[model samples]
Target chain A: MIQLLANPQRFMDFSKWAAPIFGILAVALLGTGFTLAFAVPEGVEGSGGSGDAIRFLFFHPQLATMSMAIYAAMAASAFFGFVFRHLLADAGARAAAPLGAGFTFLALATGSLWGVKTWGTWWIWDAKLTAELVLFLLYLGYMALLAAIDDETKATRAANILAMVGVINLPIIYFSVYWWNSIHQGSSMGGNHLGPDYVAPFILNMLGFAALFCALWIVRVRAEVWRRKAGALAVQAAGKS
Target chain B: MSGLGVLFRRELALAWGRGGGPMLALPFYACVATLLPLAIGADTGPLKAIATGSSWLALALTSLLSLERLFERDFEDGALDLLALGDEPLEAVCFIKCLVQWLATGAPLALAAPIAAMALGASPGLTPLIIATALLGGLGFSFTGGIGAALSIGSRRGGVLIAVIVLPLFAPPVIFGAGAISQAAAGLDWRAGFALLGGYSLFFTALGPFFMAAACRNALS
Candidate 1:
């Protein structure tokens, strides 16, 4: 299947339309999700305006989950690149870094805001929050490493190794943080604690956020592919001259 | 493994050479430990209470400082290519290099951890545990950090990049090591933390080489 897309022309043709379809779907889904999320009856109890904000506050975790999912996706793509030595996988992995970082940041920021409202602090070294921050840094490091290298293949290969190594640590980080959280004195925020009425919008925003991620990922990969093509063309023209 | 002993000795020697040895991290750690007292107000009681934990943290951060040079300096000076070409597999070479780093960086940090802890006002009773945990945890940091250093070889900025990649990966060891030190200080059963630290150290040293070797290969290519 990857071989079929190996041809740049075919990839361009397929993604040209597919990318836009996903993008439009992403915007529409997000729009509807947010609208539905805000439409819910305001307030958790006595917090008044905060209740409405807190109602959709679960989106923070959804964004975080998507962020990690993006990193996992990025790692898997890079792993394929490592195993198969395919350029598309390289492009896909490279393209996902910024998007992953963005989601991770949003997750943290939203979580922080939620914390200020709920926990009365902007930040806490709670295991979940800390782990998400680390993951965000990982994304930043991946992108920084990619940009720092002038050699394209070398950059991609090094980043692939980092991503793969990072993926191995992901489960460890998650479990360790899980254990750490259990040991700590946290006023634990479990998913089930939220009202049953809020579950619908929570799940909706989850899918909507995921759709937005996929849409951005597809478009980003296409852009990287085109950039590489342009670079190759310039090199070719220089050689001819 | 043909020249394993020779390679180890040479690495140890090179690690000790002027401007490259373990001394760099010692002073940096001291600086970090020094700042804590000032930051928290130098009340000896609080300082003593937090000393062991802060010392362990200082060890982790200092090892990180030393780790950025694990592969980068060698790669830059062309020593990495020669090592890669040698009879030893790159994986084994990476293992040995990280071992050397552990010896140079981790060993001293461990040795100093006792004094550092005491200086920060920790009781003498917990000194042994602090030393032991630092030794094991430093190896974990060294090995895991070796991967980050190797990965950053072809990249321009490495110090911060290595920290970014390595710190999250360092959490387990940090928790286990610091846990052991603090538990020992508190006169609780600390053996579990020690066991976890040992597990983390062994795990990272065993698997870190593969990624380190792979990253070095990519950087070389």
Candidate 2:
């Protein structure tokens, strides 16, 4: 699979059809998930669940998972780019960052809203929440590095290194935050044990969001490939002139 | 090894003489300490509660003050290229630079942390723990902050960019260090936080050079 996509032209061709299929899957699964989620009678999710706020379970957990998953994907691509000197991997890393950031932001927002309904506050210093906030900042830092460097090749290399470093640090950050939170106070929020009915829709929504992310990532990587080609062509034309 | 030693000494001199040495960082640390009471009002109750954390915050920011020019000055003057081509690996060179950065800036800031904490109404009894944690945490900051400094070498908005990149990386140490101090003040077992702080510093010290070296190479290329 890596060998097949090593060529930009081949990857572009593959993604042309693949993106649309993923998009269709996303729409169908998300539609079904949402319909089923809403069809459940209000205040009847899991035992001791937070009423209608439990509906957020459908969207928030999936978004939160995708947010972390995308960072992993981004760092993996960055590792490939840094190690093998693959430009496509670099492009993939760049393409995934903003989408990851968006998912992270949505996760935070939706989670905060859920908190408001259940915890009676807009925010708490929960370890998971703090780690998610750090992840969002990490995304912003990545995007900023990409924007600040004038040379595209250099930017890719620099940002790739940063991504790899973040991957190494992320677990440590989570652990530290968890430890810090534990020492400060006991978390009032208990874990939600999902019932059998909530599981299918939750899985469906997660798959839908993953599909949507994959589709968008394909499209963005394709765009990045085109942008690089154009940039090279412009440089060539300038040199000739 | 000898090459690294020489380079280390050279970087130490430059870091001290060029940037006003500890003077710059100390004043900045002092100002942050001074500002906390002023900004939050002179109530010792609230100030004491935040004292250790605020000192850690100041140390982190003060470490950042000197990082922007960590590699940029060398890169601009072509010293980085020379070092990259020398008998020493770029990794060692980066390690030396960050060590000097810690010794010149972070070390002094670490020493000042207790004073700042005390000024903010932190109990005088917490001073030793505050100093120890700050020193280890400073080591972590220098090495980790070096990665950010190296990454932003040729980029625009370098100062602010380094802060953005480094501060998130700084979070773990700050939490561990401040947690240790606060835990001690509360008459609780502080060993876990202190051990974690040491582990964080050691981990970064071991691994940060590779990242910094790679970033420096990226900028050089």
Candidate 3:
């Protein structure tokens, strides 16, 4: 399977059909999932659940998990890109970042909105929230490194190293925040579970979002490959002229 | 090893004389410490409360000021290529550069941290702990910050790129270092934070140069 996707042209060909299929599937699944989430009751008013905004659950967990899932995927591809030095792996890793950033931004924003409703404050430096913030910064750093470098191969190489370093650093960041919270007065904002009514939609939405990420990632990777190919072709045509 | 010593001494002298003078980061650190009071008004109590944290933060920010120049001039002027092609391994080159950086910027900042803290209204008793934490925390920063500097060695957007690269890596040391002082202030087991701070420095020491060398090689290639 890895060998198969190692070829950029083959990967592009496969992604052509796969991207739209996942995109349509994601749309249908998420559309139904949001409708189901709204139908869930606020669950006995004054309870710690985020009240009517409890519906935000469907978006938040999936976004949070998907953002992480995408980082993990990006890091894995980065590992491959660096170790194997394959263009497809580099393209996939590069393409996953902006989509992952979008997911992470939404996760942080939605989670904060949920926090506002439940915690009675706009923000608290909870460990989980702080960890997410760090993750978001990590993503931003990767994108910035990618954008700043003039050479395509060097940019990918440097960004891959950063990604690898980040993947290692994530656990340390999380653990340090966790320990720091424990030492400080760790706020117990505990009512953020998918309720019985919300469970089905939450699961469905998570799957949908995962599909959406996959579709976008494939599309972006294809675009990168085409961009590189066009650049090579332009050089070759210039040489002939 | 002697090669490392020579490199370290040379970098230290060069960095010292490069801009305004030796220990340029100190005034930046002090100036930052000074500004916090102005920005927040003459509120010593609140400033005192955050003295340890703010000083460490100032140290981190000030460290960034000098770091983009750590490798940029060397890479641009081709000094880095000669160093890479020299007798010492690139890893050792990385290690020595980070050491010089830590000594030139981080160590002095560590020694000056207590003064900065005092200037920001911290009591005299917290001075020793604050200095210790800053020294170790600053050490960690230099090592990891070297990776950032090396990675963005010749980029046009060097400073901002270096910050973005190093900021996330800076979190653990800041947390551990500040936690130590705060724990000491609270009359708790501050040694645990101290141990973690030491561990954080050692963690970067072991791995930081490896990454730096890789980044330098990438640029060199």
Per DockQ, the best of the predicted structures is 2
Which parts of model 1 have CA positions greater than 4 angstroms off?
A1-3, A43-50, A190-196
User: In candidate 3 chain A, where is summed lDDT lowest over 10 consecutive residues?
Assistant: A42-51
Docking tier of model 2: it is: high
By summed lDDT, the worst window of 10 consecutive residues in model 2 chain A runs over A41-50
Residue ranges of candidate 3 with Cα displaced over 4 Å: A45-50, A191-195, B18-22
Q: Model 1: clashing residue pairs?
A: A43-A51, A44-A51
Q: What does the lDDT read for residue A215 in candidate 2?
A: 97
Global fold similarity of model 1 (TM-score): 0.93
True contacts kept of each: 0.63, 0.79, 0.70
Per-residue alpha-carbon lDDT of candidate 2 for residues B120-146, written as tens digits (9 for 90 to 100)? 888999878888898899999999999
Q: Which residue pairs show backbone clashes in model 3? A: none
Rank candidates by DockQ, best first.
2, 3, 1
What local lDDT score does residue B217 receive in model 2, on the 0 to 100 scale?
A: 89
Among incorrect, acceptable, medium and high, the docking class of model 1 is: medium
For every model shown, what is its TM-score relative to the native structure?
Answer: 0.93, 0.97, 0.96
lDDT of the structure predicted as candidate 2: 0.91
**Each candidate's DockQ score against the native complex?**
0.68, 0.89, 0.78
